[model samples]
Target: IEGGLLASPPPHQYEFARLNLTYVITSKRKLAQLVYDHKVNGWDDPRIPTIVGLRRRGYTPEALQLFAERIGVTKSDSWIDYSTLEGCLREDLELKAHRGMAVLNPVKLVMTNWDEVMGVGHLEPCSQPALPHAPHGASSDAAPEGTEPPPARHFTIGKEVWIDREDFEEVPPKGYKRLFPGNKVRLKGGYVIECTGCTKDANGLITEVLATVVPDTKSGTPGSETVKVKAAITWVGVANGVNAEVRLYDRLFLDAQPDAGGKDFIESLNPNSLKVITAKVEPSLANALPGQNFQFERHGYFVADRVDHVQGRNPVFNLAVGLKDSWGK
Candidate 1:
């Protein structure tokens, strides 16, 4: 394949074109097999999103424009580290999205003081709309300059919100600080809470957790104060949340250099490549249309699937990438 791509100005232009177009093989057959076998949905499946598909999957135009500039027009096809691409994406999104809470793998968190301080209908919206910067720029001072900005987003705040199931453990791991009996952790963008205990189902699966919300530590309030803690967990408002179909995607192949070996490329497909889950998203995202990008607090970057996202119907989201910390490997 390298020789084929590098082969320049051949003995015959037509022959070269034909060979270049035909001799080069694509895994279209294997992809089709996956679809036929019912392993994958279709060519435009959210799990196997292409660049164009990603664009359709709610990637911001500004982001792609910036990425194009960052990549430049380099002719050399060297081994570009995956981190480089991920870095570009992170740089693009850091300033583009509004911060909101979501719970991907939910676990019930019940505040023991639930009815005491925060009563029924005591939901306060939590949203970060100030953003990296306010919109600006105008062709002329009289052209209404910048139009009215979008309304601020607000999420419900109360004593109960679902958290990630993985955030807790019966016995604390060496470095885990999320949830354990007698352990205290900060609910990110919210308040501090102490884990009193949890209840398990008949099969030993945790059904609910008992915690006490600290009265002095509601985020951004007058009395809210930061305290030292190893872990900060995320949450979502139960009553004011929106249900979404979140599709998690990983690299298509397990082996990075799948094509390197002259063997069936299909063998390299990752068995656990895609996972779909019904998730709870902030209310602001519920009304989102196709191609809307969002950062689901602690989960990752996501976009509404253009092919399936409908305003009044089920909202479908595709995972763009995980958090920035995993890059550079």
Candidate 2:
């Protein structure tokens, strides 16, 4: 069989790190077999370890550069832990990606006193720094020194909102700081809310969490709030949150050294590599252009899918990397 290497990315200068670097070499024939057998979607499938796959999976150029710099060129063959690569992506994105809120597994959260505090059917406007790290001189993509701060993200908080399902529990654990009966937690960039009670479904699943919103605690946050809370929860306003598809991607291999010593790599393919979920995202994210990255606050860094994402409509995002490495632990 003549080598069908046409599917491979063209040879191009990576231009990373002033120092020389080496990268893993994957077999083009095997990759093509995986593609042809339909075990993997295509050359651009995020699970594939190729340039196109990485790009489609939301790996930024800066992140890849950092990865290359961290793992310098070695004369001898050696294996690198995958966490090293993931850490590089997180480190690079933390400095540049704008922050947004998205609830992957959402449950309803109702501000019972919202009408009494902020007026009926009213949505209070809220804002947060688009790039929170810009003030600390840590923003990698900040404008010139004399230029103004980056634009702030503007959203509104209504009577109802969507919170991650993990954020609430009827029975609090030893030291849970999130929503529980009589617990107070600040809604990051919004208000300090005190949990009153909850409404449960017929099967005892908590359908709605009820809370009382504190007044004068809209955006200036911890400074303007008289009530202090140990935990700050991320939430999206139900009135304006955009419903989007979020693809959670994990490592494709179960064994670190798959296909070594004549082993069949197919046996080690991870079954739970990608999971598609309907998520509620902030309104500002609806305007996100393709290829833009954002930190989903409590969630990890994600990027708008270049091919599938449609601004203000059907948004698609892929998890580039989690906030921290949690492999083999």
CA lDDT, every model vs. true structure? 0.69, 0.83
- What is the RMSD of candidate 1? 7.2
Q: Candidate 1 — which residues are off by over 4 angstroms? A: 1-40, 46-51, 57-77, 130-150, 226-231, 325-329
Expressed as tens digits, the lDDT of each residue in 163-203 for candidate 1 is 88888887878988798888888887677888998999899
Candidate with top TM-score is: 2
TM-score of each: 0.77, 0.88
**Candidate 2 structure quality by residue, lDDT tens digits, 212-254:** 9988876574556577788999999999999999999887778
What are the RMSD figures for all models against the true structure?
A: 7.2, 7.3
Against the correct fold, how does model 1 do in TM-score?
0.77
The weakest ten consecutive residues by lDDT in model 2 span: 16-25
Candidate 1 total steric clashes: 2
lDDT of 1: 0.69
